[model samples]
Target: MTKKNVHTVPSKGGSGWDNKVGGEVVSHHHKKETAVEKGRSIARANEAEHVIHDKGGKIQQSNSYGNDPNPPKDQR
Candidate 1:
């Protein structure tokens, strides 16, 4: 199966946020939280993985939206 990854990254010049897919920017937001939410929505719609990064460009969190091979016990 193909992998879909939606990422929330920091925009240049310390302005705001950027949502990207496959290294291409898809949308820009004025807030990190908003960007994260948008990324989550995109991930869910596409059954992809959402990746959130810190301001320092370090990975902060990741969540699978759907088609998880090893879902949580509660979800299963």
Candidate 2:
């Protein structure tokens, strides 16, 4: 009777799924993907393909170092 001890019982009810496209039985429990999750997934997929944008969301100009930094080399 307890959920913890319940086994797969098809006669009354069971934790079974109907293998079908857009099945209500299966989709009911699953939550819809949020915008954040979708974005993260897209970012991950893009990273695998080495696609990324800088802070300006644009590729840095070729060989044009922006705001070049000089860390005072060997200045003791």
Candidate 3:
């Protein structure tokens, strides 16, 4: 989905202390990670697909779609 209407879902991996602090009953939107970090996470996810392709386990790398269209910083 485009950034304008990006969908966010709470993670199932809530912590042990969330309830004690009266944290939101559900987790907040997962802040998107930086490109390098996203790539790493994507790689691990793709690895799962490789397991199904038993003949060869290869995960194509993820491309960095890069920053937001209207980033806060100006071109230097």
Candidate 4:
């Protein structure tokens, strides 16, 4: 089954950050750290990926909670 990924992105109007699942906003936080924490929890629970975006809406990083199809070779 395809897991729905969670994303922490800059909110509209640029006031805060938002935790989104499957393109739907689940929660909002004034700080990016808080939003990332929330998003990580959701991603862990769902066994999905957590995608973090920069202020400019560009993808900054991502973490996989579920089984990855292509894991990095450097993983130990």
Candidate 5:
């Protein structure tokens, strides 16, 4: 399967998240929390990776729903 990533990133000119992939915006929202939830759902449905970014556009957290090449040290 083709691997895809869903991201919750700070919007360009507003307070929210820009769901993106490969630097392309796929969706937008007005609330980070909502966006994060949506991103998680999307990632789960697609069996992809969900990445959340902070207001500074820095990666905050990531969760993999599909096969991860390098999984975490702990499964718990």
Candidate 6:
């Protein structure tokens, strides 16, 4: 089964951040930090990926909580 990834993106009004799952907004926050934290929790719980986007609508970073297809070589 495929798990839907969670994403933290800028809100439509440009006033805050939003936590989205499969293109649907699940939560909203005034701070990006809060949104990211919430998104991470959701992704971890669902064993999905947490994707963060910049204000310009570009992907900033992504964290995988599930079985990664391409894991890092260094298992630090």
Tens-place lDDT per residue, model 5, 22-63, is: 668878899888899888888888889999989887889999
Candidate 4 lDDT by residue in tens digits, 1-76: 2479999999997899999987889999999999999999999998999999999999999999999877989856
Ranking by lDDT: 6, 4, 1, 5, 3, 2
C-alpha lDDT of residue 63 in model 5: 95
Q: Model 2 Cα RMSD, Å?
A: 20.6
Error of 6 at 25 (Å): 0.3
TM-score of each predicted structure versus truth: 0.84, 0.20, 0.20, 0.91, 0.83, 0.91
Model 2 per-residue lDDT tens digits across residues 1-76:
1111101111113332111112112111122223223323433433311122233334322121123244336858
What does the lDDT come to for candidate 6? 0.94
Candidate 5 is scored at a TM of 0.83
TM-score of 2: 0.20
- Candidate 3 lDDT tens digits, 6-46: 11222346311111012232123234233224323433433
Q: Give the range of the ten consecutive residues with the poorest summed lDDT in model 4.
A: 1-10
Candidate 1, residues 1-76, lDDT tens digits: the string is 2467998999976899999998888889999989999999988888999999999999999999988877878745
**Model 6 lDDT tens row, 1-76:** 2489998999999999999998899999999999999999999999999999999989999999999888989868
Error at 30, model 3, angstroms: 17
Off by over 4 Å in 1: 1-3, 72-76
User: Candidate 5 — which pairs collide?
Assistant: none
Count of steric clashes across candidates, in order: 0, 0, 0, 0, 0, 0
How displaced is residue 61 in candidate 1, in Å?
Answer: 0.6
Compute the lDDT for candidate 5: 0.85
Considering summed lDDT, which 10 consecutive residues are worst modelled in model 3? Answer: 48-57
Identify the runs in model 4 with alpha carbons over 4 angstroms from their true place: 74-76
